[model samples]
Target: MDDILKLVEEYIKEKDSKKTWVAGEDWVQYAGPYFTHEEYVRAVKTLLNGWLVLGAEANKFETKFPPLLGKELGLFVNSGSSANLLMLLALTSKRGRNLPKGTKVITPVAGFPTTINPIFQIGFEPVFVDIELDTLNLDLDAVEKACQEHPDAKVITFAHVLGNPPNMDRLMEIVKKYDLILLEDCCDALGSTYDGKKLGSFGEMASCSFYPAHHITTGEGGFVAVKDEQTERIVRSFREWGRGCYCIGKQNLLEKGSCGTRFNCWIPSLPDHVFDHKYVYEEIGYNMKPIELQASLGLVQMEKLEEIGLKRRENYRSLFKAFSKYPEFFHLHTAQPKSDPDWFAFPVTIKDGAPFKRSDICQFFESKMIQTRPYFAGNIMLQPAYEGLHDKDEVISKFPIAHKVTTDTFFLGTSPVINKEKTDYIEYILDCFVAAIRI
Candidate 1:
């Protein structure tokens, strides 16, 4: 073990060392893991311990992550997409609000597909809303109008776009006024806040990602943070293959599992017959649990969030300043009122009548080997997968902002990986693009 540890240390020192980028040869990714020797070691150590399943490491992450979101409980899952689907499942499942198939869910169209896909997958009708042009968040006025128009809508699900939140105060008022269950996709806004409250806390349930592109990385994982224990249990049942037993981690099964009656449980339908609780299936569920190795990586990643958040904010400001000089060409976003975003990117929109279109600047970045991304699935309603399924009139007349984003909006990375050297390089790339346009 000592010999192996010595070799591992050497490997981490060499491989996890600070990276250097060449202007032309290297690609400046829009997002990358801000990892270090510590995360590597923990991942290695987890494997060395032969603890491959969800045990102490997963339990630790579940305990540690929720408070950061101001959530009372959490369910660590396999991926951000799964986390989101579980949030939907927990709220709409038979043991939950249990709304029937074809229930109405109010959601935005200007978000990643996961946020919208689950609504359809779970058999809910989505009422599309346009995003605020600047912040790219769901327009609250429209959301209010949506609530008024669709009073029967039982749930409102939306993402915090590029870590930017809408006006939470007004949003909550709408949530209450309409009695809608709130499900926030905080996959991008891990460290953001509004009115001094964390972004994830404002909703009954929220999801966070730990993918390489997000604020933290656990190879591939995410979390579902719930408002209360009962909500957590429901999500857990859905997450852990719908098992009735709640025992997770190794210690819980040290005896008769966490419930102390693992083998003495009566079947729900056959109360006269008893069986092991661990094998008792409940609701229809999927296996979305994260492994102990990823959880180990997450434990270290959580410790670096404060640092990651600071760099993200710093890079966002720098990019904003760079773009400000070319105001005629770019339309920049303003963080919504009372929002202090741990921003995910520096979003830009090509203003109407601008000399260059979205593709022009995005292509310029690509040529320079600097990363850029078009806004997430722009006007998702127009995506081929959603063809003929949505209201064409809604896309044409009701969602003007959503319509523009599909053509004009794009974004750049604001992750901590954009160090001073990279930020300067990005600025140079932007200046070159603008200079060419001017000529």
Candidate 2:
């Protein structure tokens, strides 16, 4: 078996020797595929070991991840969206201090749907708010107005859109004043900082993604970080099929059962004590855990997060400088004061009356084999998924800012893999766009 594995590794290494750049590429991509041979080898070894489920490696990641973000507990899940689901479900658990039912959760309309979907799924009302164009994040003024209009709001769920941290100081003040829970969606802003603190650490709870496009790539994994013991317990319970037991994975070796007797358990007379802890259920939950293979990849990815963040920031700066010269054709998004963005993507908005439409420019990039993506779910409320989910008249016309961003905005890649060659090609394409607009 070892010899066979060695041969497979050798073949992979030989294949990787040939770097294939797509031809006729006039511009770069919105995200680059990031991976190293060593990481893949680690994943394969984990797979071969037969411990494919969450175990020691997952536990190590959970332990190390929170400290890096200045948090207490970290729970890994299958994806960032799953992490959000786990956090929301945990907040609603019967064994936990459930947030008020029908509680309104304030959120920006221009973000990923999972951020808001979990609220609705848990029977909480989501109050859509507008975002600031400068940071592409929830506008503090809009959030304040929403709170004023809906004093029943008990939670404020927002994202650091495109890696630009929101006005955390102002947002936290509102959270405290209104006695609201804050859940920061840091999936896109893993390494971002505001006022010297990490983006995900400021909120009561935070969520992060480890997809390839994010600052770090774990293929398909994510985590939720919580500040307090109670929240951590709740998070773990929800992630572990809502089990009441607080013990770690397969480590509850204590012979003294719940009733102080090895054979006598206390829950409605069960053969004097033959109860299996595996069958226990404390809260309504679902299976949302990731495999050990994913966690193995995450361990390797975490080691490079700092380097990846630096490259993303550098790429963002270069893109901004290149586009700053064409203010008439492009409006560049800016970071908030006291923010050092770990930008996920550099957003660009087409000014009103621009000679060409956004679709036209995007197609040009596509023709050149350059990839692009619209700002996440762009005005999520406007999407078909929300047609029957929300009150059309009340929300459809209210989020003007979100509407503007959804229509006029698009973002480019700042992935660490992008280099000078890619950036120069992108600039050249933009020059063509400028010339075409004048014609």
Candidate 3:
């Protein structure tokens, strides 16, 4: 093991540590895999211990993730999507403040599918609201309208889209006024702040993804942060095979029948501690726990979060500066007032009269090997997934602003891995695109 570790260390050191910028690279990805030799070693160590499941490492991540979001009670899950699933599941648990079936959840029509998928999967109706063009986040007015239209709305699940927080202060006020449970999807907005408060901390429950593209990478891990103790308990129960027992790990199983009396049992008239932990199910739950190896990687990645934030900020600023020069060609997105965005990607919109279509520009960038992505499922309501789900025939008409964004908006990579050379190359491509279309 020691010899293998040494070889791994040597290999990492021997590799060219300098960052590279290849021209015409297939759309500079939204994020790249980042890790140090130590991170790999920690993962290897966890494997060597023969403890691959959720354990101490998972516990550590769960404990620490909350502070990053300015909250308490972090529960690690298999992926960000799973974290969303668990968050919704917790709300549905009977032990929790059960949101009755068909209860409506107000969400943006422009968000990632997973954010709204759980609401449907949990048998709840989603009240789709439009997003503001400037922030690419939920339009507060539209949200209020949606709530007023649907008084039965039980929750508001909003995402800090692309790391730019919405008007959280106002949104929180609305949530409180309507007595709605606020679930912030911070999957793309970790480290972002609104009015000096972290994005995830404002909601009743918040979720994050540790996918490679996020502020930090854990390969495939995510966490749910809860504000109240009841929510926390429900989240744990949902994650832990719906087991009612809150005890940590294998110790809970051993201490069951070890009381003073030999035949003593915790449950009335039952065998002395013979209850099967695996069979002990309470709330409807799924196995969404993340492995220790992913947690170990998370620990290392967490340490470098501040540095990553800086790089992302710098890259975003550089791209903005480059794109801002041609407002006629593109409509640049802005953060909400008092928002300190840890930009996940630099978003832009092709002007309605611009000589080029979104597809043309995207193809141009692709040909240059620079990657581009549409603003997550542009106007998600337009997708076939929600076609039959909603009552409205023209969902975009309901959310006119979001529809505008869907038609004109797209995003460019501002990931930490993108350096000056890549940014310049991207700028050159954009300039060429504009010239070609103008002619």
Question: Comparing 2 and 3 by lDDT, which wins?
Answer: 3
| lDDT tens readout by residue for model 2, 1-439 | 5765677678778877875554354346677557777677777888888887787778788888886565878888888898887777767766665776797889888888898889878888888888887778888998889989999888888778988988889888999998888888888988889999988888878999887788887887789999877788778778878765665544555665332443424345455656555566667767788889888888888888888888888888888988898888788899989999888998998888777888998888788777888887888877897787667666657877687778888888999878767777777777787787787
lDDT of each: 0.87, 0.80, 0.82
What 10-residue stretch in candidate 3 is worst by lDDT?
257-266
User: What lDDT would candidate 3 get against the real structure?
Assistant: 0.82
Cand. 1 TM to true fold: 0.97
Ranking by TM-score: 1, 3, 2
**Candidates' TM-scores?**
0.97, 0.93, 0.93
Total clashing residue pairs per candidate?
0, 1, 7
* Model 1 poorest ten-residue lDDT run: 15-24
Best by TM-score: 1
**Candidate 3's error at 303, in angstroms?**
0.5
- Candidate 1 residues lying further than 4 Å off, grouped into runs, are 16-18, 391-394
Count backbone clashes in candidate 2.
1
